[model samples]
Target: MKKFWKWTNLTESNPTERILTLNGTIAEESWFDDDITPQLFKSELNSCSGNITVWINSPGGDCVAAAQIYNMLMDYKGNVTVKIDGIAASAASVIAMAGNNVMMSPVSMLMIHNPATVAMGDHNEMQKAIEMLEEVKESIINAYEIKTGMSRAKLARLMEEETWMNAKKAVELGFADSIIEPDKKINEDEKEKNKASDSILFSRRAVSVALQNKLKSHYLANAGANTGTDITDLEKRLNLLKP
Candidate 1:
């Protein structure tokens, strides 16, 4: 069976910071499958110590598996940092809520919606399925509420609407702490250079506007002297003032 998670130790000597990559579907096998059971994952997790950085890029699968993973992370002793580099939808979003510090890439997306299942039976069976789904939805809202501090009713409304959020929106909605940026360090010189560039751009636009206003005033003041000039000629003169 294909495993959804891969582990990498960042430092050989310290082994304090580990990276856990969860890609693709959360679980392709059944929840009880021996090869990909959450017990096996927990064993691997318990083998290590210190901080963990989880990188997730999944479309979501198997809500039960996701719930188990979320619980495992929450129970871990080490600090957990979750970085979503791609889409985290449906069940995957629940797992993300376990992070002590959740972050998303600028282009990453997060989606949440009501749980769904198929049922083939009479009206009684259909009602049973509906009740089950309602309970499952409430359980999901519990996770969202812990992370966002939003009211259960509001969260339920968002889930019912199938809310989608970009990195900025996720931070705004309290679903994520912040958006991830490049790790490279910028020196003071580079910072000043960027500031200078912005100032120069602003100054150029200001100069262009000032020149256009002056030309307009000049043309209007000399209107009597230049009766042959039409509005078209004045527009052409103003166009030349653009940088």
Candidate 2:
């Protein structure tokens, strides 16, 4: 059975954080296949106790599997932080809602739309399929509402419109808590240092200008005392030294 998730300890010794990477399609196993089950996922999840950081990069598949994974993450004892490093669409977005803190890479995207399925039947059977899809959509919206605190009506509309969000838009709409900007602290520190350097440079320039003025005044006074050098020559010499 193909596994969609991989677990890794972030640190080798006395690790305090774990990483769960969910890439590609959510569940590769056939729906009827029991080889790769949520129970197996749960066992792996419970193998260790630590904060979990889930990195997701999926186009989504198997809503049922996604739902089970979402529930398991929600029930986990440690804090769950979800980082969307690529696109999380459809059912994948539902799973993202399980995070206590959801973050997205600056270039990552998230998409939501109504659930779809193939159905071949008479009018009555077609109606049943439609009804089932509607119910599934509502179930997906439940997860969105819990995460975003948006009204059901609004969430439904967004799903209907197939809303797509970048990291900034996701944060603005409460779909994500923040953007995953690497080296943010280091960038901020660099900015502070640049500001300090600029201030010092400005101060040095001011001192240089003040000293130039003082020297010019003293030279002018000396020229006046000597009364021999032409005033134009003295002015030209001072101008040559002007900053």
Candidate 3:
């Protein structure tokens, strides 16, 4: 299925102040979703009246749409600042660079990769797809270089490897400026440990049940309720779902 962009304003401090937000996939289709955003961006630029804040949280969708937005931001005379509240991946990362000053949450992530395309056809069709992808990659790489002042070769390598950088790494690599402190400290390591424990516990229960059935088959024994297998499975599943 073709992906379409989504946008919604989560917060607006003052009614009179102009704050334009574009959230979700930054694809070409997003322009059609609501011409209001693009028009507002243009209007603000033409007016050159107030500072504009653009908040972006997206996985990124289309390249063409991103380029259009980037150009508009570059043309604007007013102050432009971009905030990355959640994530800015793929083309969205490029859009984030449009901001005169970019801010990313400490836990936020930014990702970049060579442009991708899907195709189903013969060798010629496959070759065409590869060529298109290469061209798109070049365009994206150029944009990154312009924004981060990074070497084209290095950025291209990072894109080729589909690098995902967190806020700290982003700042270190010059993709982002500063890390905004969140209300609460996040411990991703603890979360990952809990996830691994749950997975292992579930697998143990599943294997235990199979073993129980084998024992019963050979000994003509009934595995009573609250057997090791049942208790283990119940406890494991419950623990896994708990908040």
Note the Cα lDDT for every prediction shown: 0.84, 0.83, 0.70
Per-model tally of clashing residue pairs: 0, 0, 0
lDDT of 1 by residue, 55-162 (tens): 999998888889889999999999999999998999999999999999998679898888988898999999999999999999999999999999999889778767
List where candidate 2 sits over 4 angstroms from the true fold.
10-14, 32-36, 184-243
RMSD of each: 13.8, 21.1, 12.0
- Model 2: per-residue lDDT, tens digit, 1-243? 788889997767648999999999988776434645777899999999989999999999998888889999999999999999998998899999999999998779898888998899799999999999999998999999999999999888788767777777788778899878676565767656533123211122345457767866776788747657665675678568643
| Candidate 1: segments with Cα more than 4 A from true spot | 12-14, 32-36, 183-243
Q: What is the lDDT, from 0 to 100, of the residue 223 in candidate 2?
A: 71
Candidate 3 matches the true fold with a TM-score of 0.63
> Model 3, 50: alpha-carbon shift in Å?
2.1
Q: What's the distance in Å from true for residue 221, model 3?
A: 45
Candidate 3 lDDT, tens digit per residue, 1-243? 233322232336643345666676665455646666567656645564556677778898777778777888777776778888888988899888887888887668888877876798999999999999988889888778887999999888788657777776777777877767567666998556533123211123344557655755644454444346554465566557432
Which of the two candidates, 2 or 3, achieves a greater TM-score against the reference?
2
